[model samples]
Target: MRKFLLPLLFILLFIAESLFVQFLPGDFFGGNRILAPRFLFSALLLLTIFVGRKKGIIYAAIFGLIFDIVYIEIIGIYLFLFPFVAYVISKIMHVLQANIIVAYFVSILGIALLEIGVYEMDYLIHVTNLDFLDFLNLRLYPTLILNAAFLLIFIYPLKRYFEKYAEALRDE
Candidate 1:
């Protein structure tokens, strides 16, 4: 039951991404800004910090593959990116304190990494026509804002949950 909660929460976040886009007002000033939900990646970063890198990477791989299969035609993009981001966050956690304030910034870092990695990959494959400046203006800003809000709202509960879960696992 405890184990299932983590994956179930991720599944909810994954589904919520599309729902978020659907509910947001369709048009914005400044030529229709884009807000891609990277909430799961934020959770993954929290998972790495409060849980452990091993569990974090495992969940990342599972959820990443699901994300690719359901949300993308490209099969390997998130499949590769998720665990990669989690690994990087694990290393970063070694250098920085994992308190709420720093963790919030770290969540932002995770979102930024995921966003830039996607932009770069898409640019390389010619999937996106938006240039660097357009990417910054249209996608990065909105996406960061959206995911930042998510982290702000959920960070404490998530941190506490992960810490409790980790403690339980250690006891077993």
Candidate 2:
């Protein structure tokens, strides 16, 4: 049960993200389009920061696979990118202090990386018609606002939980 608790939490975040996007009113963006929070992405980054890079990458890959399967038609985009983002952030965190502020920047960077990955994939397949500026103004900014708000609200508690879990694992 202990081994699976972290991943289970990730799955719940994924479900919450999906539900929030679906059920919440789109007026937050003042239009029909909604900026959904990236709950799993933020959770994975926290997992990496508190737990360890190796376990973080593993969980990222697992959740990324589920994300790709459930959310998008493209299979490899998130499956590959999510773990990649975890690996990059893990390296960056080694050089910088791991704290709430740093986590916010890293989460934003992760969100940017994810967006770029999706954009590149879509471009290759010619699925997206929006220009770069439009994509930035319309989608990226709103998404950053939404996900960053979530990170602000949840980061401390989630970090505490993962830190305690990591300490327990070390003692065992």
Winning candidate number (TM-score): 1
Which digits, one per residue and each the tens of the lDDT, describe model 1 over residues 1-172?
7878988998888878878878877675345888888877888889988888999999999888998998888999998998999899889989988899998998798888888998999999999989999899899998898888889899999999988999999999
The stretch of ten residues in a row with the least summed lDDT in candidate 2 is: 27-36
lDDT of each: 0.87, 0.86
What TM-score against the true fold does each predicted structure earn? 0.95, 0.94
Cα lDDT for residue 99, candidate 2: 85
Error of 1 at 152 (Å): 0.9
Off by over 4 Å in 1: 28-31
**TM-score, candidate number 2:** 0.94
Among these predictions, the greatest lDDT belongs to 1
